[model samples]
Target: MATIVKTPAGTWKAVIRKTGWPTNAKTFRTKRDAEDWSRRTEDEMVRGVYIQRSGSERMTLEKALQRYLADVTPTKKPSTRKAETTKAKQLILNLGKYSLAALSAEIIADYRDSRLASTSKHGRPISNNTVRLELALLSHLYTVAIKEWGLGLTFNPVLNIRKPRPGPERDRRLAGDEERRLFAALNDYSNPMLRWIAVIALETVMRSSEITGLRCHQVNLQKRVAFLPDTKNGSPREVPLNETATEAFRDALDNPTRPNDCDLIFFGEPGKDGKRRPYAFTKTWGLLKRKLGMSDFRFHDFRHEGISRYAERGLSAQKLAALSGHKSMQQLKRYTHLRGEDLVRDLDALPKRRPTA
Candidate 1:
C-alpha cells in the first residue's frame, strides 16, 4: 500500500496514505532505504506511536540555542540571563552541530564528563555547580522545544545523564583581627561608598546585588526599611534597616555628586545606551580585598557574618528567616554559624540551679 519512485536526481522517495492519519512522505538515496522507512512509518502509524521528527532532525543545536537565547533568555533575571548566555556559547562550541534528534544521552553524558575535567581561564577546575547549571539550561531548552516550539523531540537527553554533585557550602567567616583591619582599610579608602556598602552588608544581611540594585524610592529612611520588588527567589522582600544600615543608605543617597538623570542609589558611569546601571565595583572590591591581605574573604561572606551575629544574639530561626528573606530554615542554617564562645557566654548568663542537700 506504499508507492516508491526514483526521482530525476536518482533518489528514491516513499509515500504512504492512511485513512485515520495524515499523508506521510520521505526521501532516501536507496530504494531499500525508502521501502524500510515506509514500512516502519506505516507500522508506527497503525500502533499510534508515530511522531514526525523531521523538524527536530533538521534543526541543529546551535540554531536552537540561538532561538532560545532570543526568545527565552530575556524573560529570566539579569544574572540568570547573563550566565545562560555564556553557557550557550560554550554549548554551541562543543555540540552545536548535532541535531536535536541526534543528541543522545550518551553524547550529553560525555559532554558533562569533559566539562567537569575542564579548567576555567583562571586555571581553576570548573566547579560542579557550573556544569550543573549548563545542563539545566540544556534540559530546559529541550522541554521548551517539545512543549512550546513543537520541535517533535520525544525526550530530553539531559534528563538521562547523571548530574555532578553540588559543591560544598562555604563557611568562611571573618576571623580575629581581620574584621578590625578590614574596617580600617575601608575607612582609609578614597571612595566613601565602599565603606558605606561594607557597613550596610555587615549590619543587614543583604546580598551585594540587592545592596547595589537599590533605587531611591525603594528605601524609606523614616520607616527604616528597604523594599525589594524583585529578588533571586522571585519573592518581594522588605529588609529592615538598623541604625548602621540606615546611616550607610543615607550617605549613599545624599551623595553631593549624585546625578539627577539616574534614580539608582549606586549609579555607575553612563553605558553605551547612555543609561546609568548599577555600580560595577567587583574588580575594585577584589583588588581592595587582595591589598588588605584578605584574598579568601568574599563579599557574600558579609551576609553570613551578619546572620551568624544575629543567631548568636538569640534571634529565633523564624525571625532570622524573615529578616534574611530565606524561604526555609534549612537555607537559613547555612548562614547561621553561632560561635562557641558566644554560646558559653549565653549559658553562663542563665540562672544556675541550686545543688540538692
Candidate 2:
C-alpha cells in the first residue's frame, strides 16, 4: 500500500508498506516516479533481494591493499617476505588512488598487460607468475574488504578474471653417477666436518635445517638412534643411524671444544670461534657440485635420493613413513614415484584361484 499527499509547499511525499521489509518513503519530481519506486520496492521486498550499500566505491584501492599486506607478510619465507613487503608497499603507493569499486575487470586486465609490458629491475621481462601473484594480492584485498571489514561489497568483480599461465615445472634429480661424483669430491675436501655432514645428509635423508639444529645429546650409539625434537611437520620422532651416519656423529663429537649446549650437533662454518651454528652447504656444496658437473641438482635432492633408494629396496609404506616422518602416504608416494614396480611384484603373490568348473 502507498499513500501520496501534497505538502503545504505543493511538493508530494510517497510512502510504501510491505511485509518482511522496512517502510520506504521518498519524494520525486512526479507522482508517477514516486509510485514506480514504491512498486519496485514492494517487488524487491517480496523476492528477498537487497544489497548492503557500499562505501567501498569511495574507498581507495591503496587503503585495502595496505591492510591485505599486513595480514600475510608474517607467513612468508624469510627470503620471500622482504621482497613481497617491498612490492606491496610500492604497489600501494602507485595504485592506491583508484576506488576499489571502480577498478573494473577490464582495468585489472589492462594492469596485468602493463606489468608484462614493463621490464623488471633485473633486465628481464616481468614474469607471468609475478603478475599473477600481484593480481592475487589485489583480489585478496577486495575479499577482506567484503568478508572481514564489513565493507558491504555487493560483488567480487575479479571472480571471472583469468590468471596468466605459470612457468614450467623443474624436475631435478641426482643420478647415481652424480652421487658417486659428489662422494669422490667430498673425500677430496680438507674440511672433514663438511664431508661427514654431506655423507650423513645423503644416507639419513635429514633436511638441511634438521642437520643444522641437531643436538649432541640426541644421538644414542647404544640404541643406534637419534631424536629429532622439532621438525618441519611439527612432530618429533626417532631416526635410527646407519653405520656411516653414526661414524659421522662420532666425528662431530671428536671436535676438541665440545660446547655445553646440547642443541646443534653438526657445526663449524668459520668465524665466531667454532661455536655451534647452523651447518652451511652453500659455499662447499656449490663448489663441489660445479666441480662434479651436476650444477642443475640441488642439495635437498639428497634427501629424495635416500628415500628413493629405500623405496627401491621394497620398504613398506608404514615403515617408510616412520623413517621419513611423513604424516601421509600421499606425501610418501611423491618421493617414491617408481614404486609401481612393487605393485607388479605383489601380483605374483596372490592366492591361487580354485579350478573353474
Q: Specify the poorest-scoring 10-residue window by lDDT in model 2.
A: 167-176
Clashing residue pairs, candidate 1? none
Error of 2 at 13 (Å): 26
Instruction: Judging by TM-score against the true structure, name the best candidate.
Output: 1
Candidate 1 lDDT, 167-259, residue by residue in tens: 987788898899999999888987787888889888989998998899999999999999999988889999999998998999899998789
- RMSD of each predicted structure: 2.4, 8.4
Q: Evaluate model 1: give its TM-score.
A: 0.92
lDDT of 2 at 176: 52
lDDT of each: 0.91, 0.73
